[model samples]
Target chain A: DTAVSQTPKYLVTQMGNDKSIKCEQNLGHDTMYWYKQDSKKFLKIMFSYNNKELIINETVPNRFSPKSPDKAHLNLHINSLELGDSAVYFCASSLSGNQETQYFGPGTRLLVL
Target chain B: QQQVKQSPQSLIVQKGGISIINCAYENTAFDYFPWYQQFPGKGPALLIAIRPDVSEKKEGRFTISFNKSAKQFSLHIMDSQPGDSATYFCAANYLGGKLIFGQGTELSVKP
Candidate 1:
Protein backbone atom coordinates (compact mmCIF):
# COMPACT_ATOMS: atom_id res chain seq x y z
CA ASP A 1 0.00 0.00 0.00
CA THR A 2 1.15 3.53 -0.65
CA ALA A 3 2.25 5.22 2.52
CA VAL A 4 1.91 8.76 1.24
CA SER A 5 0.05 9.81 -1.88
CA GLN A 6 -0.49 13.10 -3.68
CA THR A 7 -3.11 13.95 -6.24
CA PRO A 8 -2.50 15.53 -9.70
CA LYS A 9 1.04 14.14 -10.01
CA TYR A 10 1.63 16.75 -12.70
CA LEU A 11 0.02 20.18 -12.81
CA VAL A 12 0.35 22.69 -15.62
CA THR A 13 -1.55 25.95 -15.52
CA GLN A 14 -1.42 29.47 -16.79
CA MET A 15 -0.16 32.33 -14.69
CA GLY A 16 -2.60 33.86 -12.21
CA ASN A 17 -4.72 30.71 -12.15
CA ASP A 18 -5.62 28.98 -8.92
CA LYS A 19 -5.08 25.31 -8.16
CA SER A 20 -4.84 22.88 -5.32
CA ILE A 21 -2.88 19.70 -4.61
CA LYS A 22 -4.18 17.03 -2.28
CA CYS A 23 -2.04 14.75 -0.10
CA GLU A 24 -2.97 11.75 1.97
CA GLN A 25 -0.98 9.48 4.25
CA ASN A 26 -1.91 6.00 5.45
CA LEU A 27 1.09 5.60 7.74
CA GLY A 28 -0.95 6.70 10.78
CA HIS A 29 1.43 9.53 11.36
CA ASP A 30 0.57 12.65 13.27
CA THR A 31 2.96 15.04 11.54
CA MET A 32 2.67 16.06 7.88
CA TYR A 33 4.73 18.51 5.88
CA TRP A 34 4.73 20.35 2.57
CA TYR A 35 7.99 21.01 0.76
CA LYS A 36 8.92 22.76 -2.45
CA GLN A 37 11.83 21.65 -4.67
CA ASP A 38 13.12 24.23 -7.08
CA SER A 39 14.75 23.76 -10.50
CA LYS A 40 18.11 23.35 -8.80
CA LYS A 41 16.69 20.51 -6.74
CA PHE A 42 16.92 22.40 -3.46
CA LEU A 43 14.20 21.22 -1.14
CA LYS A 44 12.76 23.68 1.37
CA ILE A 45 10.08 23.14 3.97
CA MET A 46 6.97 25.24 3.55
CA PHE A 47 4.57 24.16 6.23
CA SER A 48 4.09 21.45 8.82
CA TYR A 49 1.09 20.18 10.74
CA ASN A 50 0.95 17.92 13.73
CA ASN A 51 -2.40 16.28 14.42
CA LYS A 52 -4.20 18.70 12.10
CA GLU A 53 -2.73 21.70 13.85
CA LEU A 54 -0.43 24.02 11.94
CA ILE A 55 2.91 24.21 13.71
CA ILE A 56 5.48 25.52 11.26
CA ASN A 57 5.00 28.11 8.55
CA GLU A 58 7.97 29.27 6.46
CA THR A 59 8.41 32.55 4.63
CA VAL A 60 6.17 31.47 1.78
CA PRO A 61 3.91 34.03 0.22
CA ASN A 62 0.31 34.42 1.33
CA ARG A 63 -0.80 33.11 -2.04
CA PHE A 64 0.32 29.69 -0.90
CA SER A 65 -1.73 28.11 1.84
CA PRO A 66 -1.87 24.61 3.31
CA LYS A 67 -5.01 23.16 4.80
CA SER A 68 -5.21 20.00 6.86
CA PRO A 69 -8.69 18.64 7.07
CA ASP A 70 -7.62 15.87 9.41
CA LYS A 71 -4.58 14.00 10.62
CA ALA A 72 -4.45 11.92 7.45
CA HIS A 73 -4.90 14.68 4.88
CA LEU A 74 -3.11 17.89 3.98
CA ASN A 75 -3.76 19.96 0.88
CA LEU A 76 -2.04 22.93 -0.67
CA HIS A 77 -3.90 25.77 -2.37
CA ILE A 78 -2.13 28.25 -4.53
CA ASN A 79 -3.78 31.46 -5.71
CA SER A 80 -2.49 33.60 -8.56
CA LEU A 81 0.33 31.28 -9.42
CA GLU A 82 3.32 32.93 -10.98
CA LEU A 83 6.11 31.70 -13.26
CA GLY A 84 8.37 31.31 -10.30
CA ASP A 85 5.87 28.94 -8.74
CA SER A 86 6.73 26.28 -11.27
CA ALA A 87 8.45 23.57 -9.26
CA VAL A 88 7.97 20.18 -7.67
CA TYR A 89 5.95 19.98 -4.45
CA PHE A 90 6.33 17.11 -2.06
CA CYS A 91 4.18 15.91 0.83
CA ALA A 92 5.72 13.99 3.69
CA SER A 93 4.64 12.44 6.95
CA SER A 94 6.26 11.18 10.12
CA LEU A 95 5.15 9.53 13.32
CA SER A 96 5.63 12.78 15.22
CA GLY A 97 7.24 16.18 15.00
CA ASN A 98 10.48 14.78 16.37
CA GLN A 99 10.47 11.79 14.04
CA GLU A 100 12.84 13.06 11.42
CA THR A 101 12.66 10.05 9.15
CA GLN A 102 9.89 11.34 6.90
CA TYR A 103 8.24 9.29 4.19
CA PHE A 104 7.74 11.38 1.06
CA GLY A 105 5.12 10.96 -1.60
CA PRO A 106 5.73 11.02 -5.34
CA GLY A 107 6.15 14.74 -5.89
CA THR A 108 3.65 16.86 -7.83
CA ARG A 109 5.33 18.81 -10.58
CA LEU A 110 3.62 22.14 -11.09
CA LEU A 111 4.40 24.32 -14.06
CA VAL A 112 3.02 27.80 -14.51
CA LEU A 113 3.13 29.21 -18.02
CA GLN B 1 21.70 30.10 4.54
CA GLN B 2 22.13 26.41 3.74
CA GLN B 3 22.57 24.54 6.99
CA VAL B 4 24.07 21.49 5.34
CA LYS B 5 26.75 21.69 2.68
CA GLN B 6 27.45 18.81 0.27
CA SER B 7 30.37 18.28 -2.04
CA PRO B 8 30.56 17.38 -5.74
CA GLN B 9 27.30 18.59 -7.28
CA SER B 10 27.61 15.57 -9.60
CA LEU B 11 29.73 12.43 -9.81
CA ILE B 12 30.39 9.70 -12.32
CA VAL B 13 31.71 6.32 -11.23
CA GLN B 14 32.47 3.09 -13.01
CA LYS B 15 30.61 -0.04 -12.14
CA GLY B 16 32.26 -1.87 -9.21
CA GLY B 17 33.91 1.36 -8.13
CA ILE B 18 33.37 3.09 -4.85
CA SER B 19 31.38 6.32 -4.79
CA ILE B 20 31.69 8.78 -1.94
CA ILE B 21 29.65 11.85 -1.10
CA ASN B 22 30.41 14.19 1.76
CA CYS B 23 28.30 16.60 3.80
CA ALA B 24 29.04 19.09 6.57
CA TYR B 25 26.87 20.96 9.03
CA GLU B 26 27.49 23.74 11.51
CA ASN B 27 24.57 23.01 13.82
CA THR B 28 25.80 21.10 16.83
CA ALA B 29 22.25 20.35 17.83
CA PHE B 30 21.78 18.06 14.82
CA ASP B 31 22.12 14.54 16.09
CA TYR B 32 20.42 12.50 13.41
CA PHE B 33 21.90 12.18 9.94
CA PRO B 34 20.23 10.39 7.06
CA TRP B 35 20.93 9.77 3.40
CA TYR B 36 18.10 9.77 0.90
CA GLN B 37 18.09 8.40 -2.63
CA GLN B 38 15.91 9.89 -5.35
CA PHE B 39 15.25 8.89 -8.91
CA PRO B 40 13.79 10.87 -11.77
CA GLY B 41 10.09 11.56 -11.29
CA LYS B 42 10.07 10.04 -7.84
CA GLY B 43 10.27 11.19 -4.27
CA PRO B 44 13.32 10.65 -2.12
CA ALA B 45 13.52 7.46 -0.06
CA LEU B 46 15.59 6.97 3.03
CA LEU B 47 18.47 4.61 2.41
CA ILE B 48 20.48 4.69 5.63
CA ALA B 49 20.91 6.86 8.67
CA ILE B 50 23.33 7.33 11.58
CA ARG B 51 23.48 9.10 14.89
CA PRO B 52 26.20 11.35 16.27
CA ASP B 53 27.03 8.87 19.01
CA VAL B 54 28.41 6.42 16.43
CA SER B 55 31.36 7.00 14.13
CA GLU B 56 30.27 4.53 11.44
CA LYS B 57 27.29 2.50 10.39
CA LYS B 58 27.22 -0.02 7.57
CA GLU B 59 24.32 -1.58 5.75
CA GLY B 60 25.10 -3.99 2.93
CA ARG B 61 27.02 -2.03 0.31
CA PHE B 62 26.28 1.34 1.86
CA THR B 63 28.15 2.83 4.77
CA ILE B 64 27.91 6.11 6.65
CA SER B 65 31.01 7.58 8.32
CA PHE B 66 30.41 10.36 10.75
CA ASN B 67 32.75 12.77 12.51
CA LYS B 68 31.00 14.37 15.42
CA SER B 69 33.80 16.70 16.34
CA ALA B 70 34.09 17.99 12.78
CA LYS B 71 30.32 18.04 12.39
CA GLN B 72 30.72 16.20 9.08
CA PHE B 73 29.35 13.01 7.64
CA SER B 74 29.62 11.02 4.42
CA LEU B 75 27.96 8.21 2.50
CA HIS B 76 29.93 5.53 0.72
CA ILE B 77 28.63 3.10 -1.85
CA MET B 78 30.79 0.11 -2.53
CA ASP B 79 30.68 -1.82 -5.81
CA SER B 80 28.42 0.78 -7.35
CA GLN B 81 26.24 -0.47 -10.14
CA PRO B 82 24.22 1.08 -12.94
CA GLY B 83 21.11 0.50 -10.92
CA ASP B 84 22.55 2.78 -8.27
CA SER B 85 22.55 5.80 -10.54
CA ALA B 86 20.42 8.42 -8.81
CA THR B 87 20.51 11.63 -6.83
CA TYR B 88 21.60 11.29 -3.21
CA PHE B 89 20.83 13.78 -0.49
CA CYS B 90 22.29 14.21 2.99
CA ALA B 91 20.16 15.70 5.69
CA ALA B 92 20.64 16.72 9.33
CA ASN B 93 17.99 16.73 12.01
CA TYR B 94 18.09 18.30 15.42
CA LEU B 95 16.59 16.11 18.08
CA GLY B 96 12.94 17.35 18.22
CA GLY B 97 13.49 19.75 15.35
CA LYS B 98 12.95 19.85 11.62
CA LEU B 99 15.34 18.29 9.12
CA ILE B 100 17.60 20.41 6.97
CA PHE B 101 18.85 18.85 3.70
CA GLY B 102 21.93 19.38 1.62
CA GLN B 103 22.04 20.55 -1.99
CA GLY B 104 22.07 16.91 -3.22
CA THR B 105 24.52 15.02 -5.43
CA GLU B 106 23.65 13.54 -8.82
CA LEU B 107 25.57 10.27 -9.06
CA SER B 108 25.76 8.33 -12.30
CA VAL B 109 27.25 4.85 -12.18
CA LYS B 110 28.46 3.78 -15.60
CA PRO B 111 28.19 0.14 -16.53
Candidate 2:
Protein backbone atom coordinates (compact mmCIF):
# COMPACT_ATOMS: atom_id res chain seq x y z
CA ASP A 1 0.00 0.00 0.00
CA THR A 2 1.18 3.52 -0.80
CA ALA A 3 1.40 5.99 2.02
CA VAL A 4 0.81 8.90 -0.36
CA SER A 5 -0.55 8.61 -3.87
CA GLN A 6 -1.23 11.02 -6.76
CA THR A 7 -3.21 10.34 -9.92
CA PRO A 8 -2.14 10.98 -13.52
CA LYS A 9 1.60 10.84 -12.94
CA TYR A 10 2.00 12.64 -16.25
CA LEU A 11 -0.40 15.25 -17.65
CA VAL A 12 -0.06 17.01 -20.99
CA THR A 13 -2.57 19.79 -21.62
CA GLN A 14 -2.93 22.74 -23.93
CA MET A 15 -2.76 26.32 -22.83
CA GLY A 16 -5.82 28.03 -21.34
CA ASN A 17 -7.16 24.68 -20.21
CA ASP A 18 -8.19 23.72 -16.72
CA LYS A 19 -6.86 20.70 -14.88
CA SER A 20 -6.86 19.20 -11.46
CA ILE A 21 -4.49 16.88 -9.59
CA LYS A 22 -5.74 14.64 -6.83
CA CYS A 23 -3.72 13.52 -3.79
CA GLU A 24 -4.49 11.22 -0.92
CA GLN A 25 -2.58 10.00 2.13
CA ASN A 26 -3.25 6.68 3.79
CA LEU A 27 -1.41 7.71 6.93
CA GLY A 28 -3.38 9.56 9.55
CA HIS A 29 -2.00 13.07 9.28
CA ASP A 30 -3.39 16.46 10.18
CA THR A 31 -1.53 18.62 7.70
CA MET A 32 -1.02 18.50 3.93
CA TYR A 33 0.95 20.66 1.50
CA TRP A 34 1.53 21.33 -2.18
CA TYR A 35 4.95 22.13 -3.64
CA LYS A 36 6.08 23.02 -7.12
CA GLN A 37 9.47 21.92 -8.48
CA ASP A 38 10.64 24.00 -11.40
CA SER A 39 13.07 23.08 -14.14
CA LYS A 40 15.93 24.29 -11.98
CA LYS A 41 14.83 21.75 -9.36
CA PHE A 42 13.92 24.38 -6.83
CA LEU A 43 11.07 23.19 -4.65
CA LYS A 44 8.79 25.80 -3.15
CA ILE A 45 5.75 25.54 -1.00
CA MET A 46 2.55 26.72 -2.64
CA PHE A 47 -0.09 25.93 -0.10
CA SER A 48 -0.59 24.13 3.20
CA TYR A 49 -3.74 22.94 4.90
CA ASN A 50 -4.16 21.94 8.51
CA ASN A 51 -7.10 19.80 9.44
CA LYS A 52 -8.90 20.73 6.19
CA GLU A 53 -8.42 24.46 6.85
CA LEU A 54 -6.16 26.54 4.67
CA ILE A 55 -3.35 27.78 6.87
CA ILE A 56 -0.44 28.91 4.71
CA ASN A 57 -0.91 30.26 1.21
CA GLU A 58 2.21 31.56 -0.50
CA THR A 59 2.31 34.12 -3.29
CA VAL A 60 0.68 31.71 -5.72
CA PRO A 61 -1.36 33.01 -8.61
CA ASN A 62 -5.10 33.24 -8.33
CA ARG A 63 -5.50 30.64 -11.04
CA PHE A 64 -4.17 27.98 -8.71
CA SER A 65 -6.37 26.82 -5.87
CA PRO A 66 -6.14 23.95 -3.38
CA LYS A 67 -9.09 22.23 -1.77
CA SER A 68 -8.94 19.70 1.02
CA PRO A 69 -12.20 17.77 1.18
CA ASP A 70 -10.96 15.83 4.19
CA LYS A 71 -7.88 15.40 6.30
CA ALA A 72 -6.60 12.60 4.04
CA HIS A 73 -7.19 14.26 0.66
CA LEU A 74 -6.00 17.45 -1.00
CA ASN A 75 -6.68 18.46 -4.58
CA LEU A 76 -5.13 21.22 -6.65
CA HIS A 77 -7.07 22.94 -9.41
CA ILE A 78 -5.49 25.18 -12.00
CA ASN A 79 -7.58 27.34 -14.29
CA SER A 80 -6.36 28.73 -17.60
CA LEU A 81 -3.01 27.12 -17.32
CA GLU A 82 -0.04 28.86 -18.83
CA LEU A 83 3.18 27.62 -20.37
CA GLY A 84 5.10 28.55 -17.25
CA ASP A 85 2.91 26.11 -15.31
CA SER A 86 4.96 23.22 -16.67
CA ALA A 87 6.65 21.63 -13.69
CA VAL A 88 6.51 18.71 -11.29
CA TYR A 89 3.89 19.18 -8.62
CA PHE A 90 4.36 17.27 -5.38
CA CYS A 91 1.97 16.60 -2.51
CA ALA A 92 3.22 15.98 1.01
CA SER A 93 1.66 15.28 4.40
CA SER A 94 2.91 15.67 7.94
CA LEU A 95 1.58 14.35 11.16
CA SER A 96 0.82 17.74 12.68
CA GLY A 97 1.24 21.46 12.15
CA ASN A 98 5.05 21.35 12.40
CA GLN A 99 8.20 19.62 13.64
CA GLU A 100 7.18 16.35 12.03
CA THR A 101 8.55 14.37 9.12
CA GLN A 102 6.79 14.74 5.75
CA TYR A 103 6.02 12.00 3.27
CA PHE A 104 5.74 12.85 -0.43
CA GLY A 105 3.86 11.32 -3.30
CA PRO A 106 5.37 10.17 -6.57
CA GLY A 107 4.56 13.56 -8.20
CA THR A 108 2.53 14.82 -11.14
CA ARG A 109 4.44 16.19 -14.09
CA LEU A 110 2.24 18.77 -15.79
CA LEU A 111 3.16 19.98 -19.25
CA VAL A 112 1.36 22.99 -20.68
CA LEU A 113 1.64 23.34 -24.43
CA GLN B 1 17.60 36.37 -1.86
CA GLN B 2 18.11 32.65 -2.08
CA GLN B 3 17.41 31.45 1.40
CA VAL B 4 19.30 28.19 1.03
CA LYS B 5 22.31 27.73 -1.25
CA GLN B 6 23.75 24.36 -2.26
CA SER B 7 27.12 23.96 -3.84
CA PRO B 8 28.32 21.78 -6.72
CA GLN B 9 24.98 21.60 -8.52
CA SER B 10 26.26 18.32 -9.93
CA LEU B 11 28.80 15.84 -8.73
CA ILE B 12 30.36 12.56 -9.79
CA VAL B 13 31.88 10.08 -7.41
CA GLN B 14 33.45 6.68 -7.78
CA LYS B 15 31.68 3.75 -6.27
CA GLY B 16 33.02 2.81 -2.84
CA GLY B 17 34.20 6.38 -2.32
CA ILE B 18 32.76 8.98 -0.05
CA SER B 19 30.20 11.48 -1.38
CA ILE B 20 29.79 14.85 0.23
CA ILE B 21 27.29 17.65 -0.45
CA ASN B 22 27.28 20.98 1.29
CA CYS B 23 24.56 23.56 1.97
CA ALA B 24 24.25 26.93 3.66
CA TYR B 25 21.26 28.95 4.81
CA GLU B 26 20.75 32.64 5.49
CA ASN B 27 17.88 32.40 7.93
CA THR B 28 19.01 32.02 11.49
CA ALA B 29 15.57 31.04 12.65
CA PHE B 30 15.81 27.75 10.86
CA ASP B 31 16.26 25.26 13.62
CA TYR B 32 15.59 22.12 11.64
CA PHE B 33 17.55 20.94 8.62
CA PRO B 34 16.81 17.96 6.41
CA TRP B 35 18.30 16.27 3.39
CA TYR B 36 16.19 14.64 0.68
CA GLN B 37 17.09 12.24 -2.09
CA GLN B 38 15.05 12.05 -5.28
CA PHE B 39 15.20 9.68 -8.18
CA PRO B 40 14.29 10.48 -11.75
CA GLY B 41 10.56 11.07 -12.26
CA LYS B 42 9.96 10.62 -8.53
CA GLY B 43 9.27 12.89 -5.59
CA PRO B 44 11.88 13.69 -2.99
CA ALA B 45 12.11 11.41 0.01
CA LEU B 46 13.60 12.38 3.34
CA LEU B 47 16.96 10.68 3.61
CA ILE B 48 18.07 12.19 6.87
CA ALA B 49 17.44 15.15 9.14
CA ILE B 50 19.02 16.97 12.06
CA ARG B 51 18.20 19.68 14.56
CA PRO B 52 20.35 22.58 15.69
CA ASP B 53 20.81 21.13 19.12
CA VAL B 54 22.86 18.21 17.80
CA SER B 55 26.26 18.45 16.15
CA GLU B 56 25.79 15.41 13.98
CA LYS B 57 23.75 12.27 13.37
CA LYS B 58 24.57 9.12 11.52
CA GLU B 59 22.45 6.29 10.17
CA GLY B 60 24.24 3.42 8.55
CA ARG B 61 26.34 4.89 5.77
CA PHE B 62 24.62 8.29 5.80
CA THR B 63 25.61 11.14 8.07
CA ILE B 64 24.43 14.69 8.61
CA SER B 65 26.85 17.29 9.98
CA PHE B 66 25.14 20.34 11.42
CA ASN B 67 26.74 23.63 12.36
CA LYS B 68 24.37 25.92 14.15
CA SER B 69 26.73 28.88 14.28
CA ALA B 70 27.64 28.79 10.60
CA LYS B 71 24.13 28.10 9.47
CA GLN B 72 25.46 25.27 7.37
CA PHE B 73 24.86 21.55 7.07
CA SER B 74 26.16 18.74 4.94
CA LEU B 75 25.40 15.17 3.93
CA HIS B 76 28.02 12.49 3.71
CA ILE B 77 27.58 9.09 2.16
CA MET B 78 30.16 6.47 3.01
CA ASP B 79 31.01 3.70 0.57
CA SER B 80 28.88 5.16 -2.12
CA GLN B 81 27.25 2.68 -4.44
CA PRO B 82 25.91 2.83 -7.97
CA GLY B 83 22.38 2.67 -6.69
CA ASP B 84 23.01 5.87 -4.71
CA SER B 85 22.98 8.01 -7.82
CA ALA B 86 20.26 10.61 -7.45
CA THR B 87 19.53 14.25 -6.72
CA TYR B 88 20.12 15.53 -3.21
CA PHE B 89 18.49 18.59 -1.67
CA CYS B 90 19.05 20.43 1.58
CA ALA B 91 16.10 22.08 3.27
CA ALA B 92 15.60 24.26 6.30
CA ASN B 93 12.54 25.09 8.30
CA TYR B 94 11.48 26.65 11.54
CA LEU B 95 8.44 25.77 13.54
CA GLY B 96 6.26 26.74 10.57
CA GLY B 97 4.76 24.13 8.34
CA LYS B 98 6.79 25.42 5.39
CA LEU B 99 10.18 24.24 4.15
CA ILE B 100 12.71 26.24 2.14
CA PHE B 101 14.57 23.95 -0.24
CA GLY B 102 17.90 24.52 -1.95
CA GLN B 103 18.55 23.91 -5.58
CA GLY B 104 19.06 20.17 -5.93
CA THR B 105 22.47 18.52 -6.34
CA GLU B 106 22.73 15.69 -8.82
CA LEU B 107 25.10 12.98 -7.65
CA SER B 108 26.28 10.31 -10.02
CA VAL B 109 28.08 7.30 -8.62
CA LYS B 110 30.27 5.93 -11.34
CA PRO B 111 30.68 2.18 -11.17
Chain A alone, TM-score per model: 0.97, 0.97
Among incorrect, acceptable, medium and high, the docking class of model 2 is medium
**Sequence-dependent TM-score of model 2:** 0.97
- DockQ of prediction 1: 0.72
- Taking the tens digit of each residue's C-alpha lDDT, what string does model 1 give over A1-113? 99999999999999999999999999999999999999999988899899899888889999999999999999999999999999999999998845788999999999999
Clashing pairs in 2: none
Candidate 1 ranges with C-alpha deviation above 4 Å? B95-97
Question: Model 1: per-residue lDDT, tens digit, B75-110?
Answer: 999999999999999999854437788999999999
Model 2 achieves a DockQ score of 0.73
User: C-alpha displacement of B45 in model 1, angstroms?
Assistant: 0.3
Cα lDDT tens digits, model 2, A3-103, are: 99998899999999999999999989889999999988889999989999998899999999999999999999999999999999999999774534788
Question: For candidate 1, what is the DockQ-based docking class?
Answer: medium
The root-mean-square deviation over C-alpha atoms between each candidate and the true structure, in angstroms, is: 1.2, 1.1
Measured against the true structure, the TM-scores of the candidates, in listed sequence, are 0.97, 0.97
User: What TM-score does model 1 achieve against the real structure?
Assistant: 0.97
